[model samples]
Target: MAQDFDIRGATVFSGLTPDDFTALAQVGRRESYLPGETVFSGNLRAQSFFVIADGGVEVLRREPDGSQTILARMGRGAAFGEAALLDGHPRRALGIAKGSTTCWVLDARGLARLRAEQPVVATRLVANLARGMAVRLVRASTRATQVVDQRRAANSSLGAGEARRSLMDRLFGR
Candidate 1:
């Protein structure tokens, strides 16, 4: 947070001091994406994470039958590709820009610099990322449970001449 770069809207970067912000901004750079452009591809090794500064992003999951499902719509202040913060894991989904989106992009080299030179800032960042990811995981789990419960009820209430289909199938009609 130079006296200029704003970090207040970003929950994953919350509680960081001014010095922390300066260090973070030093390592990461701002990048913009055009509408429908990919920020990161699914199934590839992830090297960075992004914090949206403007516009929106669609987090899409690749399906078994070659379909893509929109998992989330992220707007300003949202962080995506979070798994990249901890490891070089294959991304589980794709993130594409919904419009003229700008983001603070942090890659492995920058992260390494922060960890070595600004350990306190790095720890705070990692802790924040983990906390945010845990919350998201919990929400996803709750939604999945609700879907299962709904399917069970639907299956039991099936009427004659009707067939059962999954929630995804019904929503996507695929």
Candidate 2:
């Protein structure tokens, strides 16, 4: 179902032309989900990557203790379930509709078609995805570093003047 969606707004679709978007639409279909609906689950392999046309999707991860944590909230123009498509891996999290949401779904067949027939378009798409993923990686790395620092500070002996005393001792000959 080739519906009109401004795919240009999507980061992964950045630099794509109108004809390029049309080619993508020809390969994929548009789908809508209701609130609380499971768009994709960790148990399911990602058969497609979804670009939000409207509304949002909440990416959740199930913790070892049986609690689900929100990993991300993807708004319109954002793409989710892409890692699986790019890396040939299974989905590691669940994506649920936070509200009534619409997405442009490019399935494996579509991806293959793009790769084979429109190689330039496919290359651009992959490049954009890689750039986006790299930024996310950097952000995650920074967050991890912050968490480690916070944990170290919490674990350290910092009673009142203890930290100052330690610093002074280190600075001097003691």
Candidate 3:
């Protein structure tokens, strides 16, 4: 049954036709990772894009203080590492298994070969990747704006308290 699993819902394969999706799935390799195991680390050369087949993976950002912040917790059908696979750049974040996890991996070489053999499928895949990236960017921008607004509100409240303190000092001569 797993062999017939459809990848159409995965972001990387979102726009692909059924036939294209099936063809791509045939080329994907399955990989498993144990809990706390690193699936891929930041700054390493990205060799493949992955879609979670089961369980969970945590995408993390490592701070200068040697601590890690989770950027995302991905479940089944979530895809990652497309940016590096598309651009041939080093990975920007670490991917670690949150539990016993399985991923369907598609290497860059395989993707290139697919693109050469089936340009239309490749085009749809790339377009879907771009759309996914745009959505993430928009969400990040929205979160940043919300954070800034919260800080401004907190500062204004603090300023009001300070004003009250100053008025009290003047009236009480303290």
* Clash number by candidate, in order: 1, 0, 0
Clashes of 3: 0
lDDT of each: 0.81, 0.78, 0.76
Poorly placed runs, candidate 1 (over 4 Å): 1-5, 43-45, 64-66, 144-174
Off by over 4 Å in 3: 1-6, 43-47, 145-174
Q: Which candidate achieves the best TM-score against the true structure?
A: 2
Poorest lDDT segment (10 consecutive residues) of candidate 1: 1-10
Which residue pairs clash within candidate 1?
1-21
lDDT of 3 at 148: 62
Q: Give the best candidate by lDDT.
A: 1
Worst 10 residues of 2 by lDDT: 162-171
Ranking by lDDT: 1, 2, 3
Cα deviation of 112 in candidate 1 (Å)?
1.4
Candidate 3 overall lDDT versus native: 0.76
Q: Where does candidate 2 stray beyond 4 Å?
A: 1-3, 43-47, 64-66, 149-174
Per-residue lDDT of 40-80 in model 1, one digit per residue for the tens?
78543256888888888898988999998998999988887
